[model samples]
Target: MTGSLTAARAMAAAAARLRAAGVADPARDARLLLAHAARIDAARVTLIAPEELSPEIAERYEQLVSLRAIRVPVSHLTGEREFYGRRFKISGEVLDPRPETETLIEAALSEPFARVLDLGVGSGCILVTLLAERAQATGLGVDISEAACLQASANAVLHGVAERAEIRRSDWLSDVAGRFDLIVSNPPYIALDEMAGLDEEVRRHEPELALTDGGDGLGAYRRIADGVMRHLAPGGRLLVEIGPTQVAAVIALFAQAGLVDIGIVQDLDGRDRVIRARRG
Candidate 1:
């Protein structure tokens, strides 16, 4: 059915389908899908808008558009997401790296670190980005999901950090050894009750283990803060990404753990997004 449609028309129709499905950014999603369908850059889609799609690409585009109509994440459909100015391969197995997480990355880079550890290292985006930027830094990333560890390993190789980055299957830091100068995490902070109310794309498509702790949202933070004191070298820093409303509770956990110089960093939106602390 799509073979008979011009590129521009195909995009318009796809946008309509997405809009009808209640997608927030139907036009942008449509453009990205069209570019993906044609196997070309999204920026070039406009140049080819007047052209007709080959039968094969057209059918694939139609199928992807249909999937999007059901609220499947675009990154999952495309199999990639850009984070921290680098492309990270993505899947339903790992959290799709978001631009807001870059706030954590920027804060991490603000200080010099020769070694790093990433807890709950889904897709290895945080670890790999740090290794790539610091060049001399070697890091370890651990995740509870073996599938996530595998995906993160692949991403490490993809980004040319395989030699410096190690991926492991572990619950938080249970299998981790030795202390490090920097430790970072983007642990699940969504309470069990909040999971059901998330957007369909997140609730249905993202892994539940990475989105919630099956109890209060603060469980992961408590665990992280408790276990971190022993693993953090004296003067080492720990940075964690938190839900917008979790700033106070998370800071309290850090204080109870005897961490000092604790502070919060806000995302560009001005909501508290990262909590930073130093081991005494």
Candidate 2:
């Protein structure tokens, strides 16, 4: 914690200290948080840390360190996470976007869909990234949590796609109108019974509303399928990220709801992470 080296060197040394403190991915998280405070990338820290460390920068690193010691997510500490090659802001009010969901983004981008819907669009990473990539597309994002809705709205504007995206506070699609060519959701698919078994970093810090659907993991899937059935255009697709274990149940849920061409999509790790189906 004591150092006279440049800010960059100090940050790296501090991150090594964090690794000793039992933080997983300590260097990566520490480097990212420090870079945010120093207004530089983690790689540049090696050169910059040779310069004198300002009291202000030292204080900022102290705060970020304190938060991480308690298992606070790096995204929460840095206020941003990169997904699908874009950065999205995150806070306690919304679920921090996860890298795995980028698979859903990739699936959406594979097709040339013009209209999309993102249910439970926490922080708006999925929708905003898609719309940003396909500048000609228009979309709607719905979230049951008003705070999440606000965060998604902010992300939309941040990505310069607010004009083409409308974010709303709606339970599923209760308040949304019209149909979309594609619908995507990475909802609270964790079952309530499994909450206690998860790592404390997840159960203790992540928003429960974005982590579990209360009754079972499938509640969100049911709601999503119902909405897609009601609002998806012919040949439109619904791509949803599912917990690896829930693939079979979610696939059946989609089939029961009348969706066709049901299939499981794997993630970078080859897990059955997404359930995609086309409305016939």
Taking every candidate in turn, the Cα RMSD to the unseen true structure, in Å, is 1.0, 1.5
Worst 10 residues of 1 by lDDT: 1-10
RMSD of 2: 1.5
Task: In angstroms, give how far residue 50 of model 2 lies from its true place.
Answer: 1.7
Give lDDT tens digits, candidate 1, residues 1-280.
Answer: 4688889898898898899999999999999988888899888999998888889989999899999999899999999888988888999999989888999999999999988999999999999999999999999999999999999999999999999998989989789998999999999999999987898899999999999999989988998987998889989999999997898999999999999999999999988999999998
Instruction: List the lowest-lDDT window of 10 residues for candidate 2.
Output: 1-10
Itemize residue pairs with steric clashes in candidate 2: 6-49, 6-50, 6-51, 7-49, 8-49, 9-49
| Local accuracy by lDDT, each model | 0.92, 0.86
User: Which segments of candidate 1 are over 4 A away from where they belong?
Assistant: none
RMSD of 1: 1.0
Query: Where does candidate 2 stray beyond 4 Å?
Result: none
How many residue pairs clash in each candidate at the backbone level?
0, 6
Question: What is the TM-score of candidate 2?
Answer: 0.95
Per-prediction TM-score, please? Answer: 0.97, 0.95
Residue-level lDDT of model 2, residues 81-162, one tens digit each, is 8888788899988887878888888888889999999999889999899999999999999999999989999999999999
Query: What lDDT would candidate 1 get against the real structure?
Result: 0.92
